[model samples]
Target chain A: MISQFIFIIILGAAVYLFGKNVAKVRRNILLGKDTDRSDNPAERWKLMAKVALGQSKMVKRPTAAVLHLFVYVGFVIINLEVLEIMIDGIFGSHRVFAGPLGGLYGLLIGSFEVLAFLVLASCVIFLVRRNVVKLKRFTGTEMTAWPKSDANYILITEILLMAAFLTMNAADYKLQALHVGHYVTAGSFPVSALIAPLLPAGAGALEAIERGCWWFHIIGILAFLNYLPYSKHFHILLAFPNVYYSNLNAKGKFSNMASVTNEVKAMLDPSFVPETTEVSRFGVKDVTDLTWKNLMEAYTCTECGRCTSVCPANITGKLLSPRKIMMDTRDRLVELGNNIDKHGKDHTDDKSLLDNYITREELWACTTCNACVEACPVNINPLEIITEMRRYVVMEESQAPASLNNMFGNMENNGAPWKYSQADRFNWAEKG
Target chain B: MELNIPTMAQMVAEGKTPEILFWVGCAGSFDERAQKITRDICKILQHVGISYAVLGTEESCTGDPAKRAGNEFLFQMQAMANIELLNAYEVKKIVTGCPHCFNTIANEYPGLGGTYEVIHHTQLIQGLINDGKLKAEGGESFKGRRITFHDPCYLGRGNGVYEAPRAALEVLDTELVEMKRCKTNGLCCGAGGAQMFKEPEKGNKDINDERMVDVIEAKADVIASGCPFCMTMLSDGVKHLNKEQDIKVLDIAEITVRANGL
Candidate 1:
């Protein structure tokens, strides 16, 4: 009875704290400007199912895709066992469904046991891939320190959690054979059956290991739930909505600014009057200028450098890296979020996403190729942020590169990017 | 055969609305090298006996350069003026020699109250081939020569028109080699996003030169391009590497014209 009371309190506190952290992230994402993404209900759902749920994009890299499937499928299905564990925790019963479920319970637990074992193998392989093999995409300059360690920590945590789960099952299987009190012969343990012989024959020792592992497994999951918002592993939750809200239009379409449209029309025509609105900053200098979807993208980045690896600028040794842009945006957003949390919403910061995190050179190097957009397994659009920052650099400050200024002048005065008379536009049609 | 290219204004004055209004972009109209491709496109239309007219003086920049450089104000201004002119002509169908113009005017202009059936020149040529209006009869044989199609970023990745350019090449009697980075995975030619107007940022190598590595690896005897910007970049790359004699960077329209003996 006392143990059940403690279990409820721990579960309650964990859920409350996790909910609070996720809510804070939601608030931070909503701090940005609003743009409607809720229009295409049917398409968004289909895309979400394919890209996020089906892991369709991940299959582009076959090795990673297959490995990721094992872990993802295993983790989600194994958590079903947690439901049984929770009932046992709350009701102070041993395998409460054992009598009612009969044979099906054994099959369900058998599948989970096999899945748990696969999850363990996949995690170990991933750890080696990260630490030993050191894939080029994982070793970008921005992936230094915390980013690298965070990946390792998640993998290690998952491995430990799976280990505890399997150990708990193995001990329980051993105890069931001995016909110990309340140690129900319920689950078919294909994986744990092997480990059952390794466990001590003494029923008391086995009970202690089983009970200890059971407690450790649930606590580990609760802790992992909290750890998500702090790490790049947050992608597990955010990937679904992010893929749904991804730009569905042609890759060529950079959305037109309505404010710019109003201002430009008023300038072009003598009779035209601009719609009156508060003077808006031209482009994204900070997180606040970005669309909420862009902010959501920042938080959703998994820091996989498939984008950087394929980027034309980055490929040719340019400072620009799409993955770094996402990381910097998220870092800046978190910094701003913390500032608002401590010093209230009105508090200001000298540091911005530009200059402080992403540099002028880095911003200029991008070719705006959609390789990054296409390469992202999560369907994150880093090009949108890069262009928005480029807008801030050009429109807000009037600090465009001198050559681009000449090009802009040509477009404005001569109706072309180069200095050529419009009269000669038809010159190509004339007989030489 | 004499090329019959009428201005939309001239066509309108004659109470004639042609089939497709040709959007001869800034590069096609002005750039000396690109002008050749422009003429060949007009030649292809005339050969196919399709009723088409040029925007001529009525045409201006699509503002792709300004828009990409983050000057949306200039972009919309150019776009609005062009849209007003295009709408005045009641242009129903449109074609462009430049992918930049095709992308901006087709994709970006529609939101600003201008929409038309826009097709890239390669797509137009592909349609002509598919309809049996064009053929490779009595044309230069590319037999035993390797030709690679450098998928222009705007045309392929931007608009998803990968097969059309390749289809134009299919009528030719040659080996079509794909670069290591081709189609959606294709690398940029260091000329996108207003990069054509300015010097590249400090890097180990120029992006075009980097793209040339793919060209060299493909062992291409000729580089067929669909975009004018790509033609300039790929041609310059050949020249830079002193492979000018080795590789001929011809636009798809030029190759089509040469292939069909038009």
Candidate 2:
């Protein structure tokens, strides 16, 4: 009864902390302007299934894909065991489902053990890939200090969590062999059974080890849950929604600003005189200027650098890394969120996301090729964000490159992008 | 291959409603090299007996360059003017040799009440071949010649069209090779997003040069492309390598015209 009470108190506290962090991130995303992505429910659901659940894009890199698949599937499916543990902790029950589930419970437990081992192996391999193999995409300028440590931290945490679960199972198996109190002959620990022989061979030693492992594993999971909102690993939760809300329009199609369209319509029509209003900023200048979906994209970035890796601009040694674009947005958003929290709604900041975070050089380097958008396993559109910043630079500040300004002038005066008059448009066909 | 292409105003004066309006884009109109593609498309249209008329001087820029350059205001102004003109003409079933113009007119223009049945010239040629309107038997020069098609981002990944251009290429009796990255995973030719108007930032190598590496690896005698912008970039790439004389960069329409002797 005392243990159950202690379990309830700890679980409640973990839940509270996890909920607070998740809520804060949600509020941060809502700081941006609204944009409708609510249309096309069926297509959105299909995308979620294929991209997130199916891991369709992850398999582009075969070795990493397979390794990631094991870890991913294990992380998701092994949680069923966590569910059982939670119930057991609350109710003070020993192997609660084993009595009714019979051999099926054994089969499930056996599968969980195999997956746990696979997850552990994959985590170690992933650690090696990041720290030892030193993949070019992983060890970039943006991936220094905290970003690098954060990735290693997540992998290490998962490794320890899986280790704890297996250790607890191994000790429990030994306790069951000794017919100790509350130690039922329940889960068939196929993988953990090997460790049973290695454990110290006394009842008191076994009980202490089992309880320590059990408590540590649960607490570790709780810590991971709270850490997600602060880490790029937040993609674990956001990937589904991000993929679902992905832009369903053709990749080449740029979204037209309705305000600009309306203004243009008014200009074209003599009857509808546009109301004279004060100068409003055009395009995205700050976090709040971006659409809600764009903000959500920043939060959904996994920092895996797949988009950066496949980027033609980056591959050709350009300054623009799509991953860096997302990271900058997310970091700026966090700053904005913290500022709003500290200073209230009326407070202003000297810095904006454009020059303060992403530079003009990086913005112009993008080709808008949709490669970054396509390469993202979770369907984040970095091109959209880059384009928005470029729009701000050109439309708001009129700071386009001299060549682009020349083209813009040509477009404004003549009907075409060149200096040729409209009368000369047909001159090509008149040629010999 | 020379043919007299009539204007929309001339077609109206003749009291005829053509089946399609040929949207000869800015590059197709002015660029000396892209003009060849325009002429070849005209020849193919004339040979296939598909009644098509151009807007001629009435046609303006589709504002793709402006939109991509982040000048939304300029793009909107240009788009509205072209839309108003097209609406006045009641034009439907538009076709363009440039994928940039096709992408903008088909996808972007609809939101501004400028929707029309816009199709790329490659798609039109593919349709014509499929409809038995045009025949592309192995010509003397192009028979089993090594031809590699560079997938334009706007056509392939942008619009989810990977097959139509290839199908058009398939009709020609040439060895159709593919680059290392093709279709959905194809690389850009360093021209999209208004990059053509400005010099590229300092980098190890130009994107066109990198793409040229793929073309060279594919060992293609002729690099076939669907977009005129891509044609220009790839042609420059070929010229940079001084392989221009050896490897010809031809539009799919140009290839078809040569293949059919239209």
Candidate 3:
């Protein structure tokens, strides 16, 4: 009965995870219609190699970088233990590996235990750095929407993960005391020895307790896995690709003006251009207009606020905050996603998501200086989105700063931005 | 007939295989003091055995100001016409006295299929000095004169030609004091990007005014620059700040011409 329950639970969890992940991938593909320069396969691969495997972005801050590296590696390697836990739950044996393999498994578990302890220690330091140390650096100065819930979630998740680890050790001790079937518990023997003395003196009750603890450990891991897609921890999956595919050039150099022109023309006249109108306008006005990569960026934002700390515009008291823009776009996107899921695409009467969210003043205040992009640890190019929106406002709606409009008109008439006669163009020269 | 003010075609028809094309930009051709310096550069080049062709009244604005103003179409048309005119003369290279025109032709013209080797007159003068083609008399060294170089936005940040202008100043052996923000991180002269053509938005301090104080702080005898736009703005800033008598604005070309005793 226990084996059947474990098997059904594992199967259900796997299916749910796979289905949700697929839906996420599909939604992203559908949303990321505005990403420029997807033609170069070699460039994409090179970026992936450097960003994903190398952990390049995290290294911007040394202390945080070191802490993240261990957590990242620990999170990845410990999946094997998760798998082992699920298998043991079905098989009625605490140890899955036998003989030489069993010895290796014990070693791996010991190593994982040490890494877990390190990750916990680093996470504590990170918390202190963010909270007690009161370092302005850790504050997400850019994103005002960074919920207080995020810190709580991180703290609780760490504690829960540690709980899972301890419970597994307790189960291991009970199994050893019961004289379980032979499986080399080599490296784990020390853990079992320490745990054995702590187990209840009544052997009969210990077996039942061991089974219950095993179930708790498995459920704890599964619950954490399911919670990942909904939390800021979603960055663990998204940041890898986000960093890899990030623009390799300087901030302002990411997209050319010529490319933007081509896109605008294509949107206006599809028959002449033959390129399908994937999304209207240049900038991301709503969540659906954002490219999947941008949506991924929204999900991946750890709310670390590193981008805001270095923004020249923010420091100078400009209304633009790169982090806030990203979070606002993301919040609207999530709301839009929920609406779409609930009501389908036919629900067009719903109010425009962008109007209620980002203000016109916030849009105009940005100087397109790539400082925010440069400071971002996760490779979110907020300036690109900001500029694209500006382009749309200027070209499509013909709405821009009144002074800029007059300057553009003057440029059209006199070939100079000043409304002087063409004859007087060289007046400055004659005076010299 | 369309008024042909000694176009490159006419110059070529006269059997002139000019050693250089002196691109007197729109500002230099019209502004009085700027025109004098342009004429000075022409006379200097002529004396140095370098025959140069002038575009005269045929020259027009480089359309940089238009492009920066967001009139992309007008800028494109201007670029296309300039390219055709330059290519008509089989112009292999150009030397401009204007930094804006120099930068536009050197950096932006290639995008419009007009690729020619372009150099600022200051850079050419520096090269000439280096090659022993131009010699300067070291009579009384201007060493004690604290001179600061104001980096033009177009020539410095837009094109990364900071060192060449500084190099020209270094050859003169003056006490070159630098502002806190110089070279790539240099602040603008409140000109360039067509900002000169428009009234500046109300702000606590003018960018150029803020820049002039750096020169004042250095107690510099001169505020030198390679770009004519910077020269004009910095000169105006010095005067506006009532330091015109104490601090003078001189183009690197003007300074170079003086150093050569021309």
Candidate 4:
């Protein structure tokens, strides 16, 4: 009863912490600016199919893909076991895979146990890939975060998971040895048989150890769950939906410019554009300038830096790095969240929040190539955010490259990009 | 009644209910060779009993170049005016010899509610050939003429009109050698997206020059194009390399006209 009470308290605390963290993360994500204006339904559907179900981006690197897939599948399957564990801890009877369904449950648990092992093995390979193999492309990337600590966490989590699986196996083995009529133990006796030899000769000691390990496993899982919202592992939950809603259309297609008259009227009259301000513009300069979806994308990023690898500008030694853009946004959101948490809405009064995070040059360096969006495993659209900033710079602040300004002038005056007479339009053709 | 040279207004003035509206875009109207070939196409249409009205000077820029330059407002203004003009005449379909005009009219104009069935002259010529209305003379004097088609981005990737131009070239009895990058992946002639209007950003080699090298590598005697802009650029590149003496640049329409012994 005492153990059950302790487990309940821990579980409750974990659920509360996880829920709070998720809400905070969600609020931050919602606060970023939106810039994507794609209307291509076919592209959206293809993206949804490929990224969501096909796991196309993740599979581009095979080893990590396989490992991640096992972990993903195990995490999903283990949810059922979690519910069963909670029920068993509370009620004394494990009814999840009991009776007629016992065979199927035993098979599922056996398969999941094997998958968990594979997943753990894959995590080790991932560590090697990140550290020892140290692919040159990953050198300056933001995805290579605190490698040693992350590896340690991953290793501990895997061990804890395995311990949980083994504890359950040990209990089933003992029950079978004692001739106790447990549903799962009947079909799982062979697995139990192998583990039984490793157990101490004394049944009482083994039982106590089993009880302790089981609690440790459960506690470890709850702790991991609580840590999920604060760690890079947050993508384990966020990437699914982000992939589902990814943009798949042709690159560099900006959303249709809103009708200028509508915009003006909206700004002048509150009824037109309900969300308008005297100093407000249609681009993101800071966290507040971002839309909800943009923020969501920042939060959902797995920091794999696949986006940085494919960025043409980054490849050519340009200032633009898509991974850094996401990281900056995420870090800024956390900073803002911390501020808001401390000072409430008065956090907006804090001037330092806007000073040093993201720069205008960093925003302008993008070529608006959809490479970042295409390369991102979680389907974050960095180009959309970049273009949104461009729109703001161009429309609101009247800021643009001088060449663009010259082109604009030539376009207005000559109906072309040159100051030469319209007669020059056919000069080359006349020569031909 | 004397026929005033068929300006766009004059064509529109003849009657609202013409059989076809020949959209002699700015390039076709202004370029001497393009104007000559367009006149030849008009004669061919007349011979085939296809009555058409030409929208002459009233045909402004299709705003493709402007839009590509990131001047969205100018594009919208031009598009809105063009839509209004076309709507005024109740013009159902438009035919143009210019691929840029065709792409702009067919693809970009719809964004401004200016939807119309637009086709390239090559498509119409192919249709004429398929219907047995157009026939090419066999074994015409030109020999040792290995020609390659330069697939303009607006025609090839922009609208997927690859086969029609190739069909026109095939009918001309020229050996059609393809460059390395043809069809959808075809290199730009450095004239697209208003690069014709603005100086191209400094790169190691001009895009058209890079493309012409492929043409030179193919060892083709002539570079034929469906778009006038491509013809001009490729010709310039060929000339800059002093390959002008060995090579010739001709529009597919001009080649077809030549095949018909015009």
Maximum-DockQ candidate: 2
Give the best candidate by lDDT. Answer: 1
Residue-level lDDT of model 4, residues A1-432, one tens digit each, is: 786787778888888998998898877776654546456667666766677656776876787687788777777776777787888776666544556575786676677667656666676776677678986555664545563465457656865676567655666667556654442344343344566677775656766666677777778888888877766677778876676566443332344455543453454456765343343654456767777767778778766777777654555454567877877777778888888889895557443212365555555444343456656777788766666565566565667666666766665565444454555543422232
Cα lDDT, all candidates:
0.90, 0.89, 0.65, 0.66
**Cα lDDT of model 3 by residue, B1-262, tens digit:** 1111233656788987666777887667656667667766765676576766767545666776555444444455666667778887778789998777887787667765789989888788778777878765633356668878887766664555677777777877668888866764465676654556655443345556767767777788888887767777787888888977788888877777777766
* Candidate chain B TM-scores, in order: 0.98, 0.97, 0.92, 0.91
Query: What are the candidates' individual DockQ scores?
Result: 0.81, 0.82, 0.16, 0.12
Please report the TM-score between candidate 3 and the true structure. Answer: 0.70
**Comparison by TM-score, 1 against 4, better one:** 1
Clashes of each: 0, 0, 21, 9
Per-residue lDDT of model 2, residues A298-324, tens digit only: 999979998888788888988899999
TM-score of each: 0.98, 0.97, 0.70, 0.69
lDDT of 1: 0.90
Q: By DockQ, is 1 or 2 better?
A: 2
| CAPRI tier of model 3 | incorrect
**What clash pairs does model 1 have?**
none
